[model samples]
Target chain A: MTDRISNKKNITLSIIAIIVMLAAIYVLDIVIKPTSSWSNLMTCLEKGTIYALVAVSMNLLNGFTGLFSLGQAGFMLIGAYAYAIFAIAPEDRATVYQYYEGGGLIHFSLPHMLQDMMGGADAFGGTIGYYLGIILLMIFAGLITAVIAFLIGIPVLRLKSDYLAIATLGFAEIIRSFFQWEGLGPVTNGSNVLRKFASYDSSIFPVLVAGICVAFIVLLINSSYGRAFKSIRDDEIAAEAMGVNLFKHKELSFVISSFFAGVGGALLAMFQNNINAAPFTSNMTYEILLIVVIGGIGSITGSIIGAYLFVCCSEWWLRGLDAGEFLGIEADFMSPGFRKVVFAVVIMCIVLFYSRGIMGTNEFSWSGLFNFFKTLPKRIAAVPGKIKAKFSNKKHKKHTENVKEAQ
Target chain B: MEFIAKWLPYILAGISVGGQFALIAIGYTMVYGILRLINFAHGDMFMIAGLVMVYMATVLPLWVSVILVLIITVVLGCTIERVAYRPLRSAPRMSIMISAIGVSYFLQNMALYITGGLTRTYPTIDWLQKNITIMGASTKMVTIITPVLTIVLVIALVFLIKRTKIGMAMRAVSRDFDTSALMGIDINRVIAVTFIIGSFLAAVGSILYFSNYTGIMPTSGSMPGLKAFVAAVFGGIGSIPGAVVGAFVIGICENIIKGLGLTTFSDAFTFVLLIVILMVKPTGLFGEKNIDKV
Candidate 1:
């Protein structure tokens, strides 16, 4: 009875916490427009949110289910294209597919069509339409990707680590080439850029979506099914022995992960406002995987943090580095790619030094924060004394050496 | 007769390309066989090998540049193995894989920075450029040379792997890392040797590969590299001869598909082939049966 009561309290606390966070974010979202200068930061944050969602999706498969799939980019590509096609306005198809002889087969937008069928045609052309369209498109994208994952998973998931990695990598390549195929030009526009989609006016939209998705993933991770996924990660044979249904759980995890990856990809298409097969290459998958590694693989909070850091590093912090200026200094030969060189070096260092990444499968919680605050004053007080002691010890090293020699 | 006439040149092109792929796939299989790590940087090494040829041929004779390319790539391969992979030997598989990927990105970006994203024309050799008619079909001389060279190298490699003491050590190491170490096999030396051999083969492959291709870019190695890795898996990962066979099959299949007026589907078709092969035989054509211990 007491345990049940505590569980009830925990649930109520979590609900209240989530509501407060959401409310605060909603107000903040209203406050910020897509203004200049700081708007770029907001853009970076928005991009980071989508990346975090993708990273969490990867973490669900790689970190939880022990499936090293490089197919995230492929699924993302599908999702982005699906969203681009489904959400593209009826009138814009001509211009979007200008170079191609035949425009896409999709003449009417899905949401608008649905709206007309519902007899709410007047309510369909405004921001509400955009919202409904994007949500529906993203859902369709997720379902499509999940279905693809299901089919691909049947054959590819049975392969072991590096083999699986190679297979998925091939899958991504196949997806790229398929989209680039000329025969599919009527529908896919044959590698031509697809543009003019409904996008977020403010960064808060993706922030809310990604935040809720990640929280949901975290809840899933903490559940019994998640434990089964973890068990599979620990050892597949043992998981099977324990009646975990290895293939079923792996497929489920793969489908779920691909669903979010697709959603994230849809968000990516919206953010870019132009969809092309060129951008959805293995490199994109590699970058997201790098984010997952930089974040603790099994930790959702780490993925969120890592996504922010990666976005900030590449978009904001590394910009000046790329411009040939280093901390108030300028160089003549500073090429555009110096920032990436430095960034790659830093990533290598992190991979070497903190292989477990920033989180190490640990999550950030209120209790942890409370404990940190409790120790804050003591740590602050000890810093000066510790520095002084270090200085003194270095200065008195000769006497200490003499003492050691005497001993 | 008309179908044969039309398809014969493509077949020749396929065999030629197939040869280079076999060489590259051999590198993948050998490294994977020993290290049990997917050396993602291997493709970049192949790219760098091509780049070295481009840079050197502009300044030196073709033969000297070819020799220098081989040397530079060998040194590079060894250095990468020692620096990027050696320390992570005992770390988790994922960490090593990430390190390999980091090395790959670093190399590609550095090339990008140096070349300024320019696509450098691969220096052509006079003799290798000759168009020769074989069985009423004309094809580039390099195309005919590629498969022959691949076979010769494979034979020599098989000899090195089977008839030599170092090859014995290599086999032992590949069989069991700890047991070989306990038996006094120098793990580091064996790994370095594997990398050297792999890099050497990739260098030669790059030379033959770029001969047929138009130009070299930072991204050039990625496509061929991806295809070669796929070939390695399709042949069965860790099996050398299997890699060679897989490469030829992929090369020929893609070429034939390209010939079918579905040129765009060729790349996608390779993966489709991979999926089909994997479904039919998950371990690949020659991959050893997996044995698990409780």
Candidate 2:
């Protein structure tokens, strides 16, 4: 009964906390213009949310299902392209696909079409229609990606660890190439970048989307299917023995993970206000995997925390280092690439020493926080004594050495 | 005659590039054979070798820089294995692979810092750069030299693996790591030697490869590294000859794809082939199949 009550309380607390966070973000977005020097914070938050979604989806496969897939970038590419192609304004398609004959193909904007049906852009209904249309398009993008993942997963999910990794990586490369191919110029605009799409006006949009998606993921993780996925991760043979249809569960995890990855990719396109196939390389996949690792692998909350920290560090905090001055220390060696080098070294240290990362397969909880705060005084009070004892032990050793010398 | 003339350059280029890939693929195969870990930094080590040669050539003679580059690369490979991989020996396989990736990221960033993200011109040796005509096509001396040199090195390596005591230890270790260790084999030493040999071959491959290309950048090694790894997988991970054959086949097919006016899909073709091969024959062309014991 206590567990149930606490669970209800935790849910209420989390909802309130999310509302406050979103309110703060909305206020900040108004206060800080995009042109401001401190706009990196906004950029980081927006990008962080997107990366968090991708990282969580990756964790679902790698950490929960024991499938080492490196094809997040490919699915994201598909999602981005799917959204970008349809989201492009009809007028802009001419210039966007200028290389193609007859001013490109499929020239109707989904949001515009919705707007027209709801009494045009000046009406409140039209505005609601526009937002709804974008959401629908995002979902459409995700569904398209999920379908592709289902096809790819058919043959790929059967392979073991590293082979799966390479095969998925190869598929990602193939997808990238397909999008860049000149033959697909009519639809994909060849290798040229797709831009001028409908984007969210504020950071609140992505925060809301990513927040809801992560909550869903958490709920899924606590579900029966999630338990089946975990069983497969811990031991495939045992999972099979327990009647967990191995291939079915594996495929389901892959498809679901890919669905969210697609949505994340669409959000990323909105974040950048442009999309291209070239940057979706294996390196991008590595970056996402690293984020998942930095956040403890199997923890949604950890992935979210890790994404923000990674984005803030690389995009905001480390910018000063790249500018040749960090924390008021300016040196000749502190050039453009120095930040990345230092960042890499720090990552290596994390990988080598603190391999469990910030969360270590643990989720954040209100009770855990309460307990920590409850024990804070006692833990802090013992620090001085511990330090004194350590110092005195060293002193005593030195005294013993001196006595020995005298003898 | 027209067809031969038209395709000869692409074929020749394919063989030459394939030879270089084989040299690097051997490193991956040997490392994976014993360690069961993908040494992701191996490619970066190859890149570093090119960068080392570029910088070293400015201060020293070409021949001296060549030797120094080889030594430095070998040292780097061993150091990475020690610092990044050795501590994770008892950890999960994922952690070690992540460590390898971390090392790769570090090396690439280090190179970026040193080179300031500039594409450094690869220093050319006069002999390797000399132009020659083969059949109806003209090419650099390195094109012919690469295959010859690759074959020679592979033969010597094969002999070392087959006829030498160290080779016997390597075979034993790859066959069964724990049993070989319990049977008085110094696992650390054998691993170090394997890294040494791999890095040395990579350094040599870097020299030959850079001689063909115009410039070397921090990220240049990644594509080749990945492709070489694909070759290693194509040939069967643990087999050297398999890696070589896979590399040659992939190289030829890739170039042929480029020649067929599908330049964008050339890189994709390699991956397509990889997926097809993986689906049809998961053990690879020459890979030995192992039965899973539940």
Candidate 3:
């Protein structure tokens, strides 16, 4: 009875902690904003929230489920394009604004339904309508991406890890190619979607939507289904023997993960107001993989932590490369590509030394937090002794092996 | 007749490219046969060999540079086996495969960092650049050379595998690693030999490929590597002859698709082919069927 009471208390405390954290984040968002910089701060927060959403979804499949997926960007591309098609104003589509027209295949017409549904040449409605349209478009984009993921996953998921990686990569390339197709240009805007969606502020929406999506994923991860996901990750054979229908669970997780990824992609589209095939390449997938790996695979908090760190590292930390006066470095001394060089090195170093990632599969728990503080001094004191013992054991083993060889 | 006249040259060109692919595909197939691990770094090795050839050409005569590059690449291949793979002999298949990918990424990045992501151009050899006319059709010297060299190499490899004691040891090791070790075969040496031979073939393929393509980049290996891997799978990943056959099929098919004036669909066509093939034959065309023990 006391144990049950304690469990109830624990749940209540966790709920309170979540509320506190959200409140703290909101306060920080406000505090960090300079009087003149309120809009930009909000924009950054929104963008971060969007990345957090995708990272969390990626974590569900790659982290918790142990699936090495490389098609997240592809799904994102799908979502972004879907959102663009559904939400773009009809007037914007028929505009005679040409970027560079010396072309062999210059112009195409939008389908009648797309034209009519977008209110037939007057789709840019009032502010409330536009916002509502954006929300509905994002959801529709998510569902569309989920369906694509389902189709791709059905045949491709039957393959093992490496094969699965290749298959998914192929799927991503196909999707990218599909978007680039001239035949689909009328709807996709075919390398020119940015100009069409220029009026909408994509930055703010990404953060808000991304944040909400991350919260939803967190809730899902803490559920019974999440436990089953972890069980499958720990040992697939054992999980199957335990009556976890492998394909069904994998398909469900993949679809769910991809659905959020599509939404995240929609948010990303809003940020840039441009959807091109180049940024949605394997490199993007690799970047996400790096985030998951650096954060700690199979941990929800880790994915969020990793995504924020990665974005900051890419945006702020690497911003130093451009600061020639501060570092006493000339413009020529710092190659524009130095960020990638550094990022690659960091990934290699992390993989070699801290393969388990920062959180090491452990989530943020109050007890864990208390334990960390309590054990800090003891761990520090014991480090040297542990190192000495490790060396001695290694030496003993080597000596014994030498003696056995000699005999 | 008109279609044949228009498409035959493209088909032939693809076959020549396929021959180059076959050379690379064998390496993938052989390594997978023995280890059950895809050597993702093999493509980078091909890139490195091309770079090595470009460097060697500056110091030596053309034939001498080719020979020297082959020898150096073989040594590099053996060294990679010793350093990266030997220690991980007991690790999980997935870990080793991931390690291979890491190595591939590391090599490609290192190349990019060193070269500043610039495309390296090989010194123009007049003979290689020259076009050869045969039966009212024109083809580059490299195109003809690629197929001839590929055939010679394949024949030599087949003979070596069928007739040599070392080849028997390789077969034994591939069949059963521990049992071969118990039978007094030096597993390490055999594995080293496998890598050396694989790298040698990759070096040869790289040289031929660069001669045809003219410009080589750090990422030049990835597409070819992936295609070769797909070919290896298509032919039955563990079967050498199968890999060669798969390469030709992919090369020819891709070229035909390109010939159809749908260049954008080339990659898609290859993947669709892979999916369709896998659905038909999961173990691949030449792969040995096995009963699932579990």
Candidate 4:
């Protein structure tokens, strides 16, 4: 009964926290009217939410299931393209598919189609109906990707670790080229950029979508199924000994993770307001995997923190490392590619030294944060005494130097 | 007769490319055999070898540059093993693989930093570019040269693996990592030798492979490297001859698929083959199956 009460409290508190965080984002964007720094930071947060989702999903497989897959980006590609195809406005389809002259004869808009099914504007009283249709489109994107994952899982789930990595990596490459193929111009718009979809102009759309999806993953991880997956990761033989069906659980974890990756990919597309197959490369997969490693492999909180760290360092603050005119100072050799060099170096250090990463299979504890805050004043109070002692020590040194000179 | 005439050129081309794939696959197979590592950095080493050739051709004559490139690649490969891998010899399989991935990233990004992501043109080889007509199909001299060179090299490698002292040491080491060490075999030296031979073959493969493809990028190695790895798996990973045969089959099938106008999915075709192999055999055509120990 106490456990139930605490669980309820935690849920309510986190929900309240999420609402507060979203409110803060709205205030920053609409009310404060800060400069490019704030705007860039907001963009980073939005992008970070999507990455956090993908990274957490990756963690589900790599950490919990012990299945090292390199196929997240491929699933993301499917989701992004599916969402874009369905939700793109009817009029913009022609402009977007300029290379292929109106995206073939079977063009249809997902939102409008759903709006019609929902009995048009009179039924939901206007644009709300259209918004509901877009949400459904996003869900469909995830479903399509999940179905593909089920098919892909049948062949690939049986392979051991590195073999699985190479196979999935190969699959990603195949998927990328498939989207870029000139012959598929009707459905995929070929190599051309996909645009004018129902994008998340307001940051709330992505936060809600990515947040809810990630929460679902977190809940799944804490369930009995998650325990079974963890057992497989820890000791597959023992897991099998415990009567856990290895193949079934592995497939389930892979498909579920792929579903969330799909949803995250749709969120990413909306954040950027345009989609292209070029960005969904193996490098993207590597980046997300790096986040999973850096964030602490098994911890949900770690992945989120890593996502924010990655976005902030790569997008906002660490921009100074590369910018030639950073802080009005000219640093010539700090060219554009320097950040990538730096990031690679940082990952090497993290992999070598802090392999378990920041969280190390631990979640961020609310009590831990609260306790640190409670102890803050005492540490701050010690600062001035230490400073005074340093000054006195410096004066004593000066007196000793004077005595030496007089002698 | 008309169909044979039309398909014959593709067959020839596939054989030529397959020979190059065989060379690279040998490297992957050897490293996996001895160390039980995928050696992801092997591809990047090949890429660097290509870039070294491009840079060297500008400063020196082609013959000297080629020889110099081979030496540099061998040294680089050995150094990577000594530096990145030797320390992780006793670590978990996961850590070593991650370390290999890190090395690949470092090499690729370093290349990017140096070249600023530009795709550079490969130096033209005049003699290799010479055109020949066979059965109403015209092709370059390298098409004939690549397979001949590959066969000779494979013959030489087979002799080394079967008939030499170092070859015996290599076989013993791959058979059992710790037991061979107990037998007074210099494990480090044997591993270094494996890397040297693998890197040497990759360098040779890069030169001939680029001779046909004609452009070099920072990412040039990744596709061929991956496909050659697939070949290595197809052939039975630890067996050199298996890697060679797998390379040829993949090259031919891939070319035939592309010729069928599914040009967009030719890359996927290799993976499809990999999946099928994983499903049907789990091991390549020649892979030795060992019973798992608890």
C-alpha lDDT (0 to 100) for residue A84 of candidate 2: 86
Best by DockQ: 2
Rate residue B220 of model 3 by lDDT.
84
Which candidate should be chosen as best, given lDDT against the real structure? Answer: 2
lDDT of 3 by residue, A1-407 (tens): 11123567768988897678667666766566455544444555655566778888888998788787778889999988777665544355555224323222323222323444556535663444556666777889899999999999999888767677777877887888788766656556565544455224434345557767877877887798877888888889999999898888888899999999999888787777666765687557766776777788777788878888777766655656534322555675455546556666776666555767789788876666667877889899999999999999999999999999999
By descending lDDT, how would the candidates be arranged? 2, 1, 4, 3
RMSD per model, one decimal:
4.2, 3.3, 4.8, 6.9
TM-score of each: 0.92, 0.95, 0.86, 0.90
| Pairs in clash, predicted candidate 2 | none
lDDT of 2 by residue, A173-262 (tens): 889999998888889999998888887787999989988888888888899999999999999999999999999999999999999999
- Which digits, one per residue and each the tens of the lDDT, describe model 1 over residues A8-107? 6667877898789667667666766767555556668788989999999999999988899999999999889888887766778789878766566768
Ranking by TM-score: 2, 1, 4, 3
What TM-scores result for chain A when each predicted structure is judged separately against the true chain A? 0.87, 0.93, 0.79, 0.86
Residue B107 miss distance in model 3 (angstroms) = 2.9
Candidate 4: residue A75 lDDT (0-100): 94
TM-score of candidate 1 to 2 decimals: 0.92
The DockQ assigned to candidate 4 is: 0.49
Per-residue alpha-carbon lDDT of candidate 1 for residues B22-127, written as tens digits (9 for 90 to 100): 9999999899889888889888889999999999999999999999999999999999998889999998787889899888888888888778889999999878
How does each model score on lDDT? 0.86, 0.91, 0.77, 0.86
Candidate 2 residues lying further than 4 Å off, grouped into runs, are A1-5, A382-407
Q: Residues B41-63, candidate 3: write the lDDT tens digits.
A: 89888998888888778888988
- Which clashing pairs does model 3 show? A46-A207, A63-A298, A202-A270
